[model samples]
Target chain A: MRVLGVDPGLTRCGVGVVEGVAGRPLTMIGVGVVRTPADADLGHRLVAVEQGIEQWLDEHRPEFVAVERVFSQHNVRTVMGTAQASAVAMLCAARRGIPVALHTPSEVKAAVTGSGRADKAQVGAMVTRLLRLSAPPKPADAADALALAICHIWRAPAQNRLQQAVALHTAKAPKGRTA
Target chain B: MRVLGVDPGLTRCGVGVVEGVAGRPLTMIGVGVVRTPADADLGHRLVAVEQGIEQWLDEHRPEFVAVERVFSQHNVRTVMGTAQASAVAMLCAARRGIPVALHTPSEVKAAVTGSGRADKAQVGAMVTRLLRLSAPPKPADAADALALAICHIWRAPAQNRLQQAVALHTAKAPKGRTA
Candidate 1:
């Protein structure tokens, strides 16, 4: 399965695409961020965002989208922008018949770092180590994107074979069966 | 000044780069989306996004970045993913020394449509018409990015002499500074 992980923002939004299941990993496929100018009106910025997303969709055509859920921000404007960007992502996926899932920051951190409160540098270092790469991904956002992807992998049904096995067992046992 | 607009997402984050002096017409430099798979793990997806965005930054190198503000989503999972994408954008710009700006959807819509309640198609069509393009940018996300750039332009101090004048009048000449 292919999943796209997103770190949404108004000026810059991070994105990552992964395809693979446990015990095997798929290609990085691609990664990048969309940019918008300051001093330009908000309308123009939104236009830039729409354009970037469309091109990415044409390129990747992911089956499921995973996004990070926002909790709270000290800055209201920032929070609001984050929310709208989030909506934009959801909008893109829904329009394409793709399923989108969100994970909280804590959840992603825990999934990737084994601790929900891991800091950016820690997570970045861990991501590099986990991926077994020569160097850490440049820009903290990229590392966060990787964390999001890894979180989805751990959260996805495939990772929890116990549930699947139980489901299969119940299915084969016929109606009203419990495993 | 040139501005880059972004619409954040997991699979496809839309982007538009426009250049213009304050009060002058904004010109499109490039517009496209960065994409990744939906089912792949979060880590892989983020890598894809980073790579794609890096390419865009290297290719265009806008002075500023603008993005849609993220809003709340009832679905916990969806919101989380969107937030992550937003952060990715911020990191991208920060790394490139480009200042990033965030704007709400309403702000973007109002800048173009004069109404915060404008729908996607309305905003899209208006953006196309404003840019005097042959067709509306494909995909609503791209159109939104264009709208964001337009919004920044509309709100720019150099672009709106009247607003600047009002501000000057309101400031009461600022402590004997030269006129």
Candidate 2:
């Protein structure tokens, strides 16, 4: 499975793309940010986010998306910004018929570091070790995003089973047969 | 200014268009829902959301938008659907260079009812009274969405100030200056 993970922000949104086979390790396709200066207008920032996602999608072509869920922030305006960034990434995935899964920070951290309360440093260390990378990913958020995509793969078995069950039920249903 | 408010959903999205002058009340130009089946594939649902937004934008030719931001939900799949719906609305607004504002449930409730903790019935009643509706608007979500657009107008002074501040700062930047 190929997954694109995103950490949405107004100033510098983080993104990581990874591809994994059933038994093999995930290979990092790309990792980067879509940045706008803090002084930029909200419209410009939103535009940057849209362009950034589109550019990455065009290059990497990830089949699955993993994004950070909306968490509360103290600043109403900041929360609004994060919400918009999340919306942009989600739309980018939806446009291409890609399936998306939203993961909480704790969920991703735990999956990566075996602890819900693991700090970014710890998560980064674990990701570097797990992926056996030559170097740890930069900008903390990007590393976190990569870890999140790996987590979603570990957690997505239920989705496949449910889809399988539903398919079987539909296939065996009484379509046009009299009782 | 003409502002469009969209309350997005996979099966049915509520859309309302209102035109408000600088000093006058927001007057409704149109409101309705664009629905897709629950059993339809994810692609179909996204298409419905996009088509619905495109149709409304074409008809109303709105200058701005206020969208109800999707918060964390109990259901993972439902949250994914809502996020997709929201992305389509944002894309529609962004494509036209229309400024989009994100509002939380509490913010909309407080703006319409003067209480962040107001219940749905209280909110619906207050919106009807505030808008001078002959009767309560159907599908509380739709009315709440209309209330959000009106709220943006009521709160425009601050919005305009921010935009103006951004413009002034950008204008003063040293761009393409002779070295």
Candidate 3:
């Protein structure tokens, strides 16, 4: 499967595409960052992000999109901007009927480096080795994006099976009872 | 000016439109909520929100769009969902070139009832009176959406002047030099 991973941010969003499957070697299709000036209006910045993502989607045409889920952050402003960028990424994928997955930072770290507590450099090193690249992707966000794609590519099949199991169980569940 | 106000949420997003100028009576053009099932996938839910906002923009064609600025919340997940929804609202407006403004909850309360700490009922009552409606809009989100529009309509002119003043000052400032 070809997965496009997005590390969503307002000023700099990372985009990377990887083609791979579980228990197999992966190939790097593309990697880049979409940047908007800090001084730009919020709407204009968002427009630029939307356009950038659209361009990437058009060119790479990944079957799956992985986005870094915005979790708790001490800086609410930063978190809000990240969440906004994430939603845009999801919307872009949804509009194209591409399946999207959200992976937590820890999940990506653990999947890429075999440790949830792995630092940026460790994850970068692992991603470089996994993709057989001579050097790590520039800018931490780019490496992180590739990690997200790798995580989803590795995790999606198991997740789908779990979901199917849950659905089947629910289908067999008893009817609601009143007190 | 005609303003479309959005109170963004993951499950139920409140949308309202009003037309008026500062120091003049306001008219309510539309009010409703866009709802998504909780069990739906995040990407699908976000797409629903985008479509809902796009439909509103097409139908009402408001000159300006006002979105509730999400603030820090104790629940990180709730805050993230809200921020995501808010981004979709902004994207809809930005795509249409409709000027967008974000109003904080306190700002909306202050604009409607002359008190930043005004309770919801008080704001609802004020919105009812301002709009010449017999009853407050159903669902607190709906009322809050109207309040956002009212706040923006009253504040935009002054805000524009302040922005212009800052722009002028920066433009006339001395060039780079050692202090």
Candidate 4:
């Protein structure tokens, strides 16, 4: 499966594409950041983000788009920008019927580093090793983007199994029972 | 001047259009709410908002788009949705090259009711009076949207004069001298 991961931010939105399935070696297709000027008006900044994400979608056309889920508990100012950027990324994907998945920061870290509380350097190092790159993607955000894609690629299989189990159980059970 | 006002929300997005200048009586061209199912996914919700805002833009052809400024200090979950919805509204306007303006709730209230802390009912009443409508717009969000457009219409003149004053002073000052 091919997936695009987005670490959303207004100033620097990180995007990366990974191709592979669970229990197999994954390949990094592309990774980069979309930067918007700080001085630009909010409307124009959002437009820039939309354009950048659209360009990525056109170039890669991944089957799924994974966005870093935003939590309002973070720095109040930064969280708003993150939410806005993520919305743009999700919108771009959904407009084209690409499935969008959301992964929390801890989920991405835990998937790659075996610990939910892993530091940035540790996450970066793990991404470099997993992707077999000469070095970690620059700007930390890029590394996080790769981590998100890797996490989604690894977790999806297990999730699908759970979903299938539930479906089968539901079908075999007595009728007229509500969830 | 024609202005479209947007009060952004995930479940119910309010939109209104007003036409007139700062001093003269304003006309309420249109007012309504765009609703998305609460169970809908985030990306689809945003797409719905974009389509709704775009339809308003096409029908009204407003010169300016005024959206309520989202603050992260509000209900955490609700605030994130508001920020996301507002981003989509701004994106729709900016993509079309229409000037976008953000008005705070306090500013909208102050512009209409002469008090920044005015209650929603007061603001709604004033909007009705200003627009010479027989009744206030239904759903507080709709009223708030009209208030936003009215606020933008009334404030733009003063803001313009302030800009002109600063430009004039700069032109009269010595050149090549840093402040």
Tell me the lDDT of candidate 1: 0.66
**C-alpha lDDT of residue A129 in model 1:** 78
Better-scoring candidate (TM-score), 2 or 3? 3
CA lDDT of every candidate: 0.66, 0.71, 0.82, 0.83
Candidate 2 residue B138 Cα shift, in angstroms, is 1.0
Please report, as a value between 0 and 1, the fraction of native contacts recovered by candidate 3.
Answer: 0.34
List clashing residue pairs in candidate 4. Answer: none
Docking class of 4: incorrect
lDDT of 2 by residue, A68-157 (tens): 887553344565567667777776675565666778888998888889999989998988887778888888878987897788777866
Q: Residue A54 in candidate 2 has what lDDT?
A: 81
Task: Kindly give the stretch of ten consecutive residues in candidate 1 chain B with the minimal lDDT sum.
Answer: B170-179
Residue-level lDDT tens digits of model 3 in B1-179: 78889999988888889999999999999888888667867777787788788888888898788899888675766888898889989877766666678889999999999999999999999999999998999888889999999998899687745644543444323111100
Give candidate 2 misplaced runs (Cα > 4 Å). A41-44, A71-80, A155-179, B7-13, B20-27, B34-50, B68-88, B101-134, B150-179
Clashing pairs in 2: none
Off by over 4 Å in 3: A158-179, B158-179
- Writing each residue's lDDT as its tens digit, candidate 3 over A1-179 gives 88899999988899899998999999999888888778866776777788889988988998888999887575766887898999999988876667778899999999999999999999999999999999999899899999999998899687745644543444323221100
Lowest lDDT block of 10, candidate 2 chain B: B170-179
Q: Model 2 in CAPRI terms: which quality?
A: incorrect
In candidate 1, stretches whose alpha carbon ends up further than 4 angstroms from where it belongs are A1-179, B73-75, B158-179
Please report the TM-score between candidate 2 and the true structure.
0.69
Most DockQ-accurate candidate: 3
What is candidate 4's CA lDDT for residue B87? Answer: 91
